[model samples]
Target: MPWPSPPVVATGFPGAVAPVRVGRQGIYDRRRTLVAYELLFRNHGGASADLAEGAEQDHATSQVISATFGDFGVGQIAGDKPLFINLTRGFFTGELPIPFPPHQVVLELLENVEVDEEVMAGLRRLKDQGYRIAVDDFIGEPGRLPALGLADYVKIDVAAAGDAFDEVLALAREHSRDALVVVERIEDDALFARCLAAGADLFQGYGLQRPVTLEAVSLTPSQLVCLQLVRALTGTDVPIREIEDLVASDPALSLRVLKTVVSAATGTKNEITSLRQAIVMLGPQQLCSWVVLMLLGGVTGVDTESLTMVLARAAACARLAPAVADLAYTVGLLSGVASVLGMPEADLVDTTGVAGTVREALVQRHGPAGAALRAVLAYEEDEPCAITGTGHAVYEVSRAYLAALSDAMLTVGAVAGDS
Candidate 1:
C-alpha cells in the first residue's frame, strides 16, 4: 500500500516529524521469525504511560503516531512487517482519527476499552474497512469476551495470568478460534517452552536473546566541539548567525551541517552552499538533534561497536519514552560517557551541569528518566526482570531496542561514509 502523506504543522515541517518517541517489540510466529511489532509509548521515568483516558492519553497516542509515521518511517522501523498499535477508547470508537491504512497496521484494542454495543459496532465498521483487530492483555475477563469474537489476534500476558495462564490461553483459543493466540512476556527458556507446549501460535519475550554490556572510553577535541554546540543550541537562545559561527568554527561540523541540510532538501532546485544558510535552513531545533546524533557517532576514541551501541540505545530511549525526549536522549547518550571517558558515572554526572533528575538518572538511575534509562539498559543487557520495577513492559523495552538498532546502524553508516 502507498504510504499516507505526513501531516504538516505550523513549522512547515511534517507535524508527524515532531519530537515524539515510540517503542516496539517483535512478535514471532511458531517458526521464530518476526511477523509483526507492537509499538508502545514510554512516559517519564521509563514506565509505559497509562494510555486509557484524558488529554495525556491523547497526546501520548498522537506522539506515537507521529514518531512511527514521521521521524522514524515505518519502513525503516518495521519494513514490510505489519505494526500492532494499541488504541484507546477514542481511537477504538472512531472518535479519534486512525491515520494508518488498514493493510499496514493491526489496531490493538486495550483491555480497558469497554467492548459494549457501540464499540462492537465500531469494531465491525473498522473490520469492514480492512483493519485487523487484536485484543490486548487478554486474561479472559468476562466483560472483554465480546471482543474476542471479532479479534484477529488475542494476546495473553503469561506473567499476569500466572496460575490461570493455561485456562486463559484455552479460553482465547476457544472463543477466538480463528485468532492467533500470542503468548507474551516469555522471559526465560522455561516460560517459552511452556508457552510453545501450550500451543501458542506466536511468541515474544527476552528468552530469545540477552542484552549486551557497553564499556567506557575517551573523546577527541572535535567531538567535544560538537557537544559544546549541542549545549549551546539547547541552552540559552542563540542567534542563527552566532550558531552559524559555531558551526563554521569546526570544519568537520560545518561539513556535516551542510551535508545534512543538502540531504534533507534533496530534489530542491537550489543547492545549499554555506554553513549559515545550512543552519538557517535546517533550523536550530533540528540542528541540535542532528548534532546530538553526530556526537554519538563522532566520538573519537570510542570503538565503532561501542559507539554504535550507545547511539542505538540513546535513540531507542528517546523513541520509547518521548515524554522526556531531551532527557531520555541525554541519558541514553551519556550513559556511556563515564565509561567512554574512563571516569565514574557520578563524576560525569557532576560535571555535565545536567538537571537533578538527569543527574539522578545518570548517577543513581532514579526517577522516570532514570527508570527509562534502566529499562533501556536492561533490555540491552537482556535482563527482563530488571525492567519490572522500572514501570516499563518487557515488550516496550524490546521494541525500543529493535527500533534503535535500525536507527543507530543508519547513523553510523552515514557518519562513517562522511568521515
Candidate 2:
C-alpha cells in the first residue's frame, strides 16, 4: 500500500489580508455534544452584509479557506473538533491542496457541485487521504446518490424532505450503513424529536431556538394583552404614569418587572416599593422592551432554553449597532415570532406598531438596524453576513453574544422566578 498524500492548498496572496475573524456553528450529535463546526466567512468592519454572491462569494470563500490554513491554522480555529468545510466545484477538482491534517477535515460537497469522473476521482483520493466527506443539502434516492460510497455523512434538508424523510433515511442507511445521517432545518422540539426517532445521527438549524410553524398558530389571551399594551405604548407617547398603571394592574407582569428590577438593582440601590418606581428605575423604554420580551416568550410557549437564546440574540444585535440598538433589540426579540406564532412577520410588526425602520429590517434587511439584526441572526446560524461598518469582527461579535447570554439568563431567570 502507498502512503496517503496530504491536502492540496493554494499559495497565499502575498498582500491579501483575510477578514479579522471567522464564524462557526456546531453540528451536534444525538447526545447534543458538538461533533464538528461548519465554518462561515465573515467580513471585518460592517461591509455589505449579504452572503457574497457570484464571483464575490467565490473569492470570499477562497479567502476564508486560504486564511484558515494561512494565518489562523485549523487547530486554533476548531480545537480538537473536526472542521466541516464547504468546497466549491472549482476547489473540489482543482490542484489546490487543503492545508489541514486529513483526519480533522470533512469536505462538504455543495449540493450543486458538478459531479463527474474527475470529481469522483477527487472524492476517492480525499477518502484515501483520511478526509471525511459530506454531501451538503443531499436529496436523492439511495441508488442514485452522488458521492454515496465515498461520503461519511449525508445532510438532508427536513423542509425539503417532507414526507420522504423516513424513506430517505432508510435508503441512506441501507446503502451506507456506517455513514451519519444529518438532518438540517429542523424547526422545533417536536420535529427534532421526530428526526431522532427516525434515526438521525446529527442535527442543525434554529428549530432548537424556537418553535417551527408547520401550521397556523393562535395567540393566547395573555399574549394578546401583551401585544396590545406594547402597541399602545409604542404607538403613542403615553404618560409614564399611565404606562405604570397598565403594568401595575397586571399582577404577573408587575411581579416580573419588580423582580427583574430588584434583582438587578441588588447592591446598587435602595428597595423599591411600587411598580411605578420600578418602571422609572428600569427606564421606561428598556422596561417596556423586557415586557415585550416576556410577551413574545409567553406567546411562543418557549422553554427556558429558547427564551434565553432569543434574548441573547437580541442583546447581541444591540451591541453590534449601538446607534440603533433599541430598534435592533426589538428586531432580535421578535425575529422568531413568525415561526412561533405562525403569523406573517409583517402582520406581527404591524400589530405591534414597531418602528417602520425596524419593520423594514425584519422584513427586508433595509437599514443599519436591519444590518445589525441580520448579523446577529447570521452568526446564530453560522452563515455569512454582509457586515457593513468599521472594526466589527468575529471576536467582538462573539464577545457580545456571550455577554448578552449572561445578562439575558439573569433577566429571564428573574422573570421566570417572579412569574
Candidate 3:
C-alpha cells in the first residue's frame, strides 16, 4: 500500500483501499478529453509474498483493479464514450483481474511480455466482441503489428525515448489513421505545448497542471477587493443591491460580471449596467449563480483536484445507477469530505443527509445498496472476484454491469442507481 496523490490518479493502499491511485496519467484531450490512465501495481500475485509459505495472503492486492479500474472500463468517464487503460501482458496470459470494459478503457497491451498466438487470438476475440485494443510502450516492434492492428489506440511513451520521438510519431502515424496516437509522459509546459503541435491528439502527465497561487498573478489591491466582492455574493443571504454596489464600486468587477451574465449557458442572460440597474436585472438568484460559477471556474491546479475526484467518482457511480446518480453523487462527495477536511467518514455521514440505503452500504455493508457499493469499491480495489465470493466468483455479465457503473462515471457522468 502506498500514499495516494493527485485527483484522478489513485494507488492501492493497505488501509481503506478507497480509490487506488495509479502512477503515470494522461488525458487524450482536456476539453474533449479521452479517458486514459496507467496502473502501478504493488502485486500481480507474482511477487515473493504470493510465493511465501503460510505468509498472510494479500488476497486484496488486486483490489485496485476491481473496485476502481473496473468503474472506468465500462464507459464511466464520459457515458458510452471511449477511454483507454493499460493492461499488462500477465493479465492476458495469467489470471489477473480485468474489471473494466473492453469498450471503454481500451486495453493498452504492455510490451514487457511475449504475445503468443493464444494472446493474439484472445485479443482478436475481444476486438470482434467490441473491445477497443491499444498497444503500450510501443517502439516499432514488428512482432506487435498483429496486436496493434486490433488496437484502437497506440500509446507511445515519449518521455522514455525522447531522442527518437519523431520516428515513433512517424511509426504511430503509419499504424494509426483511425486509431489515435497518444503522446504520453509530457512533464513540462514546454513539452506539453510541443506535443500538441506535433499532431498529438492526447496528452498525459503532471506538466500541464500546477498549483495555482493567487499571489503570483498580477493584481492590484482594488482588483482583489473586487474579486472578493464577487466571491462574497455567493452566500444566499447577500442582497442584490449590496452586490450591485460592490460591483459598481469597482468597474473591473462590473465588467467581469456583465460578461459572465451574458455568457452563462445554464441561466437566461440579463443585460444591465450600473449598480442598481444590474441588481434589478439579474435579481438575487442569478447573481449568486453567476458569482459561484465564476469562483469555481477561476479555481485551478490542486485547488480543483478534490473536486475532480468527487465528480469523477460520482460520474462513475452514475453510469452504474442512473436512477441513483443523485444519491451516489451526494454519497461520493461526502465520502471524500474526510480526505479533504482531515476528518473521518464516520463523523459525517449522519450529518450529510445521505439516504438510509447508501449510509448502510457505506458504513455497515449490510443494506441493499451494500453489494452495489462493495462492487464499486471492489472494482476500485481491482477485485473483480468480489462481485462473486472469491473462488465462487466467476466472470459474468452482472459483474460487468457493476464495473460499468463505476467506469461510466468517467466516460459518461454521474447517474442515480437503484438500491
Each candidate structure's count of clashing pairs: 13, 15, 60
lDDT agreement of model 3 with the native: 0.46
lDDT top scorer: 1
- What TM value does model 2 have? 0.43
User: Could you tell me how far off, in angstroms, the CA of residue 413 lies in candidate 1 after the best superposition?
Assistant: 40
Cα lDDT tens digits, model 1, 156-272, are 999899999999998998899999998878898788878989999988776763322111112321555566677788877777766764554343344345444533432355533
Residue-level lDDT of model 3, residues 182-227, one tens digit each, is 6767688788677777777777665653211111010011323335
Candidate 3 stretches with Cα past 4 Å from truth are 1-24, 30-36, 42-63, 67-83, 209-419
lDDT by residue for model 2 (1-419), tens: 32222112112211111223456667788877767777766555543225544455455555455444433445546677877777766556754434344656788887766678888888888788778988887666443375776789988888888898888788777766788988988777798899999899998876543211111122221343356567767766778867754553332344345444533332444544334566677665556555454442323222445445656766777788887765566566556434433457686554343345666877887776677766666556554333323235655666677787788677557545544
Which candidate, 2 or 3, would have the higher TM-score against the true structure? Answer: 2
Off by over 4 Å in 1: 1-18, 44-52, 209-419
Q: Worst 10-residue stretch by lDDT in candidate 3?
A: 212-221
